[model samples]
Structure formats: C-alpha cells, structure tokens
Target: MFYFSVSMREVAFIKQNKEKWLNFEKTIYNNQFKNPDELSSLYIHLMNDLAYAQTYYPKSKTISYLNQLASAAFQRIYRTKREKTNRFISFWKTEVPLIVYQFRRYVLYSFLIFGLFVTIGAVSAAYDDSFVRLILGDGYVNTTLENIEKGDPVAIYKSGSNWGSFIGITLNNLYVGLLSFIYGVFGGFGTGYILMHNGIMVGAFQYFFHDQGVLWESVRGIWIHGAMEIFAIVIEGAAGLLLGASILFPKTYSRMASFKMGLKNGIKILISTFPFTFAAGFLEGFVTRYSNIMPNWLSVGIILITLSMISFYYLIYPHIVHRKLKTHVSTL
Candidate 1:
C-alpha cells in the first residue's frame, strides 16, 4: 500500500512537469535559444528536478523520465561548449564540407555553363582577329601588344608591390564572388550571366595571348594562380544556383522555408571559397610577377598542385566526409 502511494505521488509530480520537460526538448533540438541565460536557468531547474526524482522515486518511470531529460540537456550543453571552443575547426571539418556535398549538382551545372562560354570565346577569337580585339578592348589589346614587342607580354602582373597587389586583388575577387552569390535571389539567371561574362573574358584573354604567340608563356604565368581563382568563381556560381533552385523547386518544404535553408547553405559554400581565393590572390601578387623568371617546370608544378588541392577539397573530400558521417550515423 505504501509503495502504491509512492507511485501515485511520483505520477502526480511527472504530470506537473511533463509539459515543461517536453518544451525544453523541443527548444533544444530546434535551436531556439535566443536567450542562453534563460536556457541555463532552465537547465539548472531541470537538474534539481532530476535530483529530487532520483532521491524519492529511484526505480519509478518518473525517475526514468527525469533522467533522460537531464541527460539530453547535458548533452546539449556539452555540444554547445564544444561548438564554441572549436568553432573554426568544426566549420572546415564538418559545416562547409557537408554543405558542399549537399549541393554538388549545382556546382556541375555551373561548371558546364562556364566551360561552354569559354569555348565560345576561344572559337570566336580563333576565327576572327577582330573578335579578340573587340572582346579584350582596344586599349588593353594595344598595351599588351606593346608589352609583347618589349618582350614582356606578361609585364602587367608586375604592376604593384606584392602585398599591395595581394590586398587589392583579394578584395576585388571577394567582391565579385559576393556579387555572384547575392544575385541568386533573381532565380539564378544573374549568376549564369556573371559566369558567362567571366568565361568569355578568360577565353578572350587567353586567345589574345595565343594571337600574340605567347600562349604557352601566358599560361605558365597566369595559371599559377588562375586555377584556384577560376575554380572559386565556379563554386560561387554554384552557390547562387542553389538559392535560385530552392525557390523554383521547394519540394515538400514551404517556399520560405526552402529559401531560408538554401540561403543558409549557399552562404556556407561561398565561405568555403575564401581561403582559396586569398591564396590565389597571394600567388598572383607575389609569385606570378616572376613568371618570366621561374622555370617552366616549377610554374606548371604550382598550377598543378593548386588545381589538385581545390579539386580534392571541393569535389573529393566532401564525398569522403559524407560517407564517413553516414557510416557513423548508421552505427549509432
């Protein structure tokens, strides 16, 4: 009879706090912590409740419920602590890489569009001498020709102090990347336009070098940094496409919800390009200037390594990470 009464009292206690406990769980999982202090207070209150239940209702279902809630709260707290401590490490290791894996199809599509534009530019330049001059602009073409005559076709890369050029180029590239991403709000057409424009410019630029009979020389110089720079632009385009795609095909999610998720995810992918963009700019400013002096093999080697690193991180590492994460979850 005493045991029955004890069980009844435990049941009554659970009935009183069950809603609050469930609400806490909902808030924790949903990441609705606008006021972390409030959450901390609630956590303390929950711990106290768990202690009471453990002392009086040890073997009861009420005690079990409290224990689980406490455990969840603890886990959440521990996770939050880790996230704060390892914010940068977590971002590269998990956040950005996962986002890249999730939106790979967009990346491929962006790459195809860019490649098509490059081909168009190259073909146009090949068939029409006027086409290179037109696309590249008269002043730029004339200046490059003058430099070529001076036996310094790639002299433009030596224009500024290494650090000065690095800062300027990095900022410009970042701005371009940001614009490419921001334009996705227009249903991705803007991003495609940017990609097409840049692709044509690259093709025209390369063709001009070829027309001047400096194709190989220009490549050895420009590609030392162009590999990463160009690759980052393509990735940025992919991010924009993701934004446009979410709105066009929300699937089961509401349009707003889909847009929010896309925006969040797109930003992550864009951020992942920053380090590469900076590296490219650094190489362009400090190293590309000496392209004429560097050994052909050394220049080619740098370009190859840059391409490999970008390819592996954006294209290959994501797959490895996704598979590993999936396996980890399956084990759980």
Candidate 2:
C-alpha cells in the first residue's frame, strides 16, 4: 500500500510486482538469510527505497513509510547473516584476526586472574597442608595421593568409555566455560575468582605431588592432557574478561549495547574453543589415566605432541590467518 503513491506508473509497477516482491521477502524471512545473494538483493532494494523516498516524496507519508520499510528490511537482513565478509578465506583473513586482536587483552586479564588466585592458594596452603584438600575435595586429593604412593599419580583421570566420556565431558566442560564467560558481569572479579580457583587447584595439586617425590611423573602424566585442558581454561578466562570489559567500558555504545557485543564475541570465541576442549577432555579422560600403562617416554611424547598441537592451533594459526588476510586486503 505505501509503495503505491508516487504516480500511476509507480503504483501500477508496485501492483504488478507486489506478489513477486512479497514472495522474495518471504523466502528471505524463512531462510534467515543463509544465502548471500538474497541479502544482496534486500540491500539493493533498501537503497533504492531510501533514494526514492528522498527524491520524489521527501515530505510525504509514503516517503516516511518507505523509509520505515527500508530500515526494517535492512535490520532483518543483517541480523541473521551479520557476516561482514563473504568466503572462508575472508573469514580466516578478517574475522579470525579480529578475534585474536580482541583476545590479546583477554590474555593479560587471564594472567592477572591466575596470579591473584595463586597468591591466595599459596597463602592458604602455607598455613595448612590440608588446604589443598579443602580447595580440591578431600576425595580427589586422597585418591591422587594414593596414586602417588602407588607410583601412578595421574591414574584418577582414566576411567569411562571413550565415546561417552568424550561427549559428556566435552559438553559439561563447555557449559562451565560458558558460565565463566557469562559471570563476568558481576564486576568480572567473580569470573577471575573462578579462574584463580582453577589455578590454585593446579598449584596445590602439583605441589602435593611434588611433596610426594613424583613431580616429574605428575608433570609427564598430568600435562599430557593439562597442556590443552589448561589452555582451554585460560581461553575461557579471556572470554570472561571480554564480557567484563564490555560492562566496564561502554565506549561508543550504551552499556547494554557494549555488553551485548562483548557477549557475542565472547560466545563465538567460546564456541571456537570447543574442538580444543573436546580433544583435551578426551585426553584427560582416556590418556592421562593410562599414563602408567604406557612407557614413561611414550607418555612424555604424548605430552609434547598435545602441547605442540595446542600452541599451533590457538596461537600460531590465528597469526597465520591474520597475516594471510592482510595480504589479501593489500591486493584488493
């Protein structure tokens, strides 16, 4: 009805094309804009509608209506398919790098969080040897201690069917990761505490194992999965900091807008970390427990391999993706 007021020619054009336009818009709505071409079409239509609104009926109700329609169309199209770039190459080059850039700040926040937690844990452990048991349940500490006495300190990790363990552990770990990111809103200090609680647990766990004369065994066995698993935790901490920072500094947008944007980025980064977490969880549930079953050298080798893979994917890969994108941007 609104697109009918410019002239009889314009009105007749709208009447003739109305069904076609409605059909096209309906398709876009149903698809949620998975197809890039549909978005491009909507973009073109939005621009044309705005231009006509400004040209022929700048002060009319039809012009206002066209502007509203154009805005609605633009919002709908972008909301579902908010990708700023087109291909996998573009995503790697542009999107991936942006994640790394934003994530740098997250890294520092993570370190600071770990430091604070370690200090508290150390102070507590110094006051009482049982402090480690308090932080990591007595059941866990006692079982680990028995494993240490038996010369298989990391054996607690290995029990459960690989497939079931993989799915259950991965999904549960992801939920923990998401909760850590979401809890950053409580001034971010809460998220920092969660991270530190983890760091403290590790510090105490290692110290207890070291106190038992099996530090290297613990390192070789534990780190086989710890490298990837620890890195996943740190990455999750970074995500929480991102959400926290959004609340702390709104920048150009309102506080709500900034938080929402941070949450979006944080969630994406969290999802990206899943494959790594899954591998880590699998290793923890399957490999570390069986460290005693394997040769000492073989266990060490697995540790090195897992560490290498984590470093490559999380740190090295992001940089490579960033550099490649910069080259593409230069060429364009």
Best by TM-score: 1
Q: By how many angstroms RMSD does model 2 differ from the true structure?
A: 12.2
**Per-prediction TM-score to the true structure, in the order listed:** 0.75, 0.68
Clashes of 2: 0
Model 2, 1-332: lDDT tens digits are 22333666556645665565555445543555656556656656655665764776565455544443443343344344446666664444445445655466676678677767767776677668888888888898878877767767776776577777767877877877877787888767767877977888877777776677788878888888788877777788888888898899664346886788678777767766777788888887767767777897898888888888867666677667545543433332
Q: How many residue pairs clash in all the candidates, one count each?
A: 0, 0
Where is model 1 more than 4 Å wrong at Cα? 1-85
Error of 1 at 152 (Å): 2.1
Model 2 lowest lDDT segment of ten: 323-332
Instruction: Write one digit per residue (lDDT tens) for candidate 1, span 1-332.
Output: 01123567777886777778777766665776665455666677777788888888787655555554554444344345435547778778766776777677899999999999998998888888898878878988888888899988888889989999999999999999999999998899999989998999898899889877999989999999999999999999999999999888765347897799789889989999999999999999999999999988999999999999999999999888767654443333
Flag regions of model 2 displaced more than 4 Å. 1-94, 119-123
| Colliding pairs, model 2 | none
Give each model's whole-structure lDDT.
0.82, 0.68
Give the per-residue Cα lDDT of candidate 1 at 63: 59
